[model samples]
Target: MILPITIYGHPVLRKVAKDIDKDYPELEKFKEDMWQTMYFSDGVGLAAPQVGKSIRMFVIDCSNFADEEPELEGFKKMFVNAKITERTGEEWSMSEGCLSIPGLNEDITRPEHIKIEYYDENWEFHEDEYSGFAARVIQHEYDHLEGILFTDHCAPIKKRLLKGKLTAISKGNFKAKYRFTLAK
Candidate 1:
C-alpha cells in the first residue's frame, strides 16, 4: 500500500497510542498493508503512526543483504503489539535514522540485549531474546509505538539545531522533490 508517512512535528506522531484491541477484524489485513508499505518505501521498520494510525503496532524486516551470492531467499520478521519484556544491563550506542525523520540521523544508546513478547503476523504470541543490531532495531521500533521519536533522545545541542527545520518539515513548508527509491 505504501501509505504516506507522517513526518516530524505531526501531532499524531506525538500522541500516545492506544493498544490494539482484540476485536478489530481488519487487524490481519492491516498487518499485510504495513508490510507492503514498508517494502515499497524501502524502510526497515514502519509504525502505525507513520501510516496515520494511532494504534500500538509496527512492522520490521531486517533479513535483506546478508548474502552477496544471491542463492538464498531473504527472511522477513514482523512484530505486532510488541513490548519489551526484559532488558539486560549492558548498553551500546548506534546511529539510527527514522523513516519519519528523513535526512536526520543520530547516535542513540540502548540496551544491548532484550527479551520481547509480541504477536506475529498470524496474531499468535511469541517470545524471543535478541542481541546486537536486532535488539537495537526492536528497541527503536518499540519506541515508535509509544509516540516517542528519535529526536526525543537527541542531545540538547542537536535538538536546538534541528528545532526550526523540524518545525518547517512538520508544517510541510519543505517539499520533498522526489521519493527515495531503491536503485537497481
Candidate 2:
C-alpha cells in the first residue's frame, strides 16, 4: 500500500522516533509499504515519521542516479533502528526535496561520508559506510528519525524567506503528485 505522507507542520514529523525490533507489528508488511510509497511518490528515501509512524526506519533506492554514480546502480535497502556512528569528509551542498515537504526543494549542506549501523529486513545487524550521494540521502532520511528537517539546516535568512511558503504548505496550498495529509 502507498501510505499517505504526512505534510509539513504535522506533529509526528517533529517527534523523535523510537527504535523497533523484529517483533514490531507487521514489520515485514510495513517495510514493503514504505518502499511502495517511496517509489510511488518518486522519492529516493522515505522515513517512518514521514508516514506518521514514530519508528527508526527508512528506505532508500538510488538506482535513478546510476548514470552519475555507477556504484549506486540497483542499490536499494531498508534501514531499521539506524544510528550514524560517524560523519567524515568535507561537507557539500546538494538540492534536496522531501515527500513530506512537497513542492519545496532546498540546497542543503551535508557531510560527504558516514558510518552507520542498522538492521536489514531480515533482522540481521550490519554496520556500513557510504559516501557521496548515498551518504547525503541516508543523512536526509536519518534526520527525520531525529525530528529534524532539511530546511532546519538552511541559512537563517533562507528560513525567514521560506516562512510564508512553508505556512502555505502547512495549510494545504501546495500541489503534490502523491497522496498526503495536512496537519489538523
Candidate 3:
C-alpha cells in the first residue's frame, strides 16, 4: 500500500518518533509498504513520520544515483532504531529535498562521513560507515526521526523568504502530486 505522506505543519512531523522492537505489529509488512510509498512518491528516502507513523524507522533506495556514484548502486536499506555513533570529516553543502515538504530544495551543510548503528528489516543489527551521497541521504532521513525537517537547515534569510511558500504547503495550497493529509 502507498501510504499518504504527512505534509508540513502536521504534528506528527514535529514529534520525535519512538523506537520499536521486533514484536511490533506486522513489522515486515510495514517496511514493504514504506518502500512502496517511497517509490510511488518519487522519493529516494522515506521516514516513518512522513507516513504518519511515530516510529524510529526509515527506508532508502539510492539506485538512481548509480551513474554518478557507482558505490551507491543497489544501495537499498531499511534502518530501524538507527543512531549515528560518529560523524567525521569536513562539512559540505548539498542540495536536499523532502517528500513531505514537496517542490522545494535547499543547500544544507552536513558532515562528509558517518558511522551508524541500526537494525535491518530482519532484525539483524549492523554498524556501518558511509560517506558522500550515501551519508547525506542517511542524515536527511535520520533527521525525520528527530522531528527535524530539511527546511530547518535553511539560512535565516532563506527561511524568511520561504515562509509564504511553507505556509501554503502547510495549508494544502500547493499543487502537490502526492496526496498529503492535512492535520486536523
Candidate 4:
C-alpha cells in the first residue's frame, strides 16, 4: 500500500519520533509500503513521520538519479532507529524538497560527511559513514525523526520569503500529484 503522506503543519511532523524495537507490528509491511509511497510520490527518500507514523525509520532509493549522482546508483536502503554519531567535514548547500511540504524546494546547508549507527529492516545493526549526496539524504531524513524540516534550515530572509507558501501548504492550499492527508 502507498500510504497517504501527511501534509505540512500536521502535529506529528513536529513531535520527536520514538524508536521501535523488533516487535514493532508489521514492520516489514510498513517498509514495503514506504517504498511504494516514496516511488509513487517521486521522492528519493521518505521518513516515517512523513507517512504519519512517528517512528524512527526511513527509506532511501536513489536509483532514479543514477546519471547525475552515480555514487548513489543502486543505493536503496532502510534505516531503523538510526543515530547520527557525528556530522563532520565542511558544510555544503544542496537543493532539497520534502513530501510533507510539497511544491517547496530550497538549498539547505549540511555537513559533507556523517557517521551513523542504525538497524536494517531485518533488525541487523550496522555502523557506517557516508558523504556527498548519500550523507545529505540521510541527514534530511534524520531531521524528520528529530522533528526538523529542511525549511527550518533556510536562511532568515529565505524563510521569510517562503512564509506565504508554507502557510498555504499548512492550510491545505497546495496540490501534489500524490495522495496526502492535510491537517484539519
Ten consecutive residues with minimal summed lDDT in candidate 2? 20-29
Candidate 4, clashing residue pairs?
A: none
List residue ranges in candidate 1 displaced over 4 A.
65-75, 173-184
Model 1 lDDT per residue over 25-141, tens place: 688778888888787777878888877788878877767634532321354677777888899968878789887777667888888889999887677999989776677777888
Error of 2 at 33 (Å): 0.7
- Prediction 4 global C-alpha lDDT: 0.93
Greater lDDT among 1 and 3 belongs to 3
Q: Evaluate model 4: give its TM-score.
A: 0.96
Q: State how far residue 43 of model 2 sits from its true place (Å).
A: 0.6
lDDT of 3 by residue, 1-184 (tens): 8889999999999999999999999888898999999999999999999999999999999989999999998999999999999999999998898999888888999999999999999899999999999999999999999999999998899999999999988888766667678888
| Structural similarity to truth (TM-score) of each candidate | 0.84, 0.98, 0.97, 0.96
lDDT of 3 at 93: 99
Local distance difference test, candidate 3: 0.93
Q: Which pairs in model 1 have colliding backbones?
A: none
RMSD of each: 5.2, 0.6, 0.9, 1.1
Task: Find the candidate with the highest TM-score and give its number.
Answer: 2
Ranking by TM-score: 2, 3, 4, 1
Q: What is the C-alpha local distance difference test score of candidate 1? A: 0.75
For model 3, which pairs clash?
none
Residue-level lDDT of model 4, residues 25-89, one tens digit each, is: 99889989999999999999999999999999999987676798788888999999999999999
lDDT of each: 0.75, 0.95, 0.93, 0.93
* Best prediction by lDDT: 2
